[model samples]
Target: MTRRSASTGRWTGSSRCCPLKTRPVCRSQNPRSSNEPLAQGSPASCTAAVPGRERKSRQAGRPDVTKLLVLGAGGQVGWELVRSLQPLGEVVACDRRRADLSEPATLGALVADVKPAVVVNAAAYTAVDRAEQEFDLAQTVNGVAPGILAQAARSAGALFVHYSTDYVFDGSGHEPRKESAPVAPVNAYGRSKRAGEERVAAAGGDWLVLRTSWVYAARGQNFVRTMLRLAAERESLRVVDDQVGAPTSARLIADASAQLIRQALDERSRGSFGSELLHLCAAGETSWHGFAAAILEGWRELAGADSLKLRELAAIPTRDYPTPAARPLNSRLDCTRLEERYDLRLPDWRAGLMLVLAELARKD
Candidate 1:
């Protein structure tokens, strides 16, 4: 089954990668086993076979298949994960309906049932401002649930992957924050996410926590889409310029995750796998006001200046635009560790924004 993306108008496979009701268990025909040694040479060469490893599956005959369970399949990053993880293994993608993170107790049963080789949790309570009033709900979903999921994955001998945010930091310094930096979340949402990270770590499992900043995608409610919508409605826009960070796309995050998964699986088989936290985001940075300008600029280049009502874009400091939640000024996350470890070179924020804008333009 397939569904059309509202933003891009492109047909994409359904969230469920395999029919769990009919098949019960889905497996890919990828010939490479977890125990197989990675190809020699650069990391690029080592992972080059990941997307096409299934070509020789028929010849190899019933090769080992990795079953991956992805939660929050309806989300932007989760949606992309369903597509990107297909080549790596048999994916059992579950939206909130199938796996509700709000009810953490139920997750163990689901994990036990699927018995996946890997468990990726992309679900979270992301309403930053609303979380101020509903901190309990946010904590239940973001904080408690991930720990439960991680523990379940540990019991099942499955590698657990979870996503965090730069909001975990207090945003005091101007420098890009390393993974080892002290965490001091400034808002309720950040506190909840920080709790989730600590819980996942305490669960004692082979887990990976990827901390990212300003995530957006073509097919979701994101900064890029929101900017486009506002441009179409308002003649002039006032955006906050104080907060700065890289606007990482969901597609990039999913693709990089698949690559990391492939490497981790190989290492796991060789008894060299270890749990770690890493920051992943696009290269470079920009303020929200700058990001808004870029979005409008990209839209104008793609759809023409006459297509938007946005004329003047004004920049204001955080003090000028106050909210219920206190936002961190510095949201930049250092990706040097992720880059060196995975041998991956992340694209610039502008490059990613342009690609999303182009996708949105295709729908028009």
Candidate 2:
């Protein structure tokens, strides 16, 4: 498929090359409007910007050890980022309380005040089903806020890193979607996220948008948590079998973000850093039923003979379980661009799932 550059209005096919970065792009090229009302959140209460010491640190050619700002420090990926980003710099982590994406205007101000050398936006409006009802709020938070953050990063001369979803695709074919593939989001949430991607690209900054799928963590309310809770309370469980994607762990995503951030910082030192979108998810794919089964089997082994009363597991089609929002049947993503550029590759889904199971067992 031919990849069109939203920045340069040029086309490139199948090559690992980037479009020429001439100047800051305009707003009309972006389909999403930034004038939407902000999502619900208070303005930033940070009085002083980042300390002067950090500014000096940037000039001394040691920006890696400078201030690294991360938005959404409370979610699964955000929680892991606190620890993962420490190696790169003095991690100034902000949850919704500190830096809320819903309050879009505040984000730009907060970013400007903080003046971070690197900005990683892990925060997003991820309520897939609820997004159908709150389309405006979702678009405001997921779409406009990212563009605000990206522009702030540009003004502060910081590299922007954002996360996206496989939902950007319609999920028609069994093959993994590449970065160059045409996007056709089926649900409101997907449309909002895709809008965020466009806005970020149009902002014309040094940015990296990592698109992942089926994300879960040891903490937070994810698929694994839901399955475990249901298994303990019910006699059986029914999971959809038609949908397929890699179950990417939050820890893995955090680690990969750190790696990519480090590389971006290193490139900046050489007076150059380019922006590109890439896929970053666990290797291989499986249906939701298969993922649930693996989680249960792993938990059973860890619990010895005293496992949950999960007597039976049933696989159902997507049509059998209607939801407020439609889910893509295929969430698989091709990560060749990521692997080739960063010399990085994720481990298989099973390996990461085992680690998560082990962590959960330890907590118990």
Per-residue lDDT of model 2, residues 202-316, tens digit only: 9997999999888777776567776777788777767778888988888888888888888898898777778999999888899988998899999999986467987888888
Cα displacement (angstroms), candidate 2, residue 49, comes to 16
Could you give candidate 1's per-residue lDDT for residues 1-364 as a string of tens digits?
Answer: 0111221011011110111111121111111231322121211111111232332222222235576888767677888888899888777777655676767888888887776678999877676666788888888888898999999999888899999989989999799999999999998878988998999999997999999888777875566776778679878877878888888888888988998998898788778888999999999999988888888888999999899997888887878765667888899999999888877888888988898899999987
The number of the candidate with the highest lDDT is 1
RMSD of 2: 10.9
> What TM-score do all the candidates reach, one by one?
0.83, 0.85
What's the distance in Å from true for residue 209, model 2?
Answer: 0.5
Tell me the spans in candidate 2 whose CA falls farther than 4 Å from its real position: 1-65
Deviation of model 1 at 219, angstroms = 1.1
lDDT of each: 0.74, 0.74
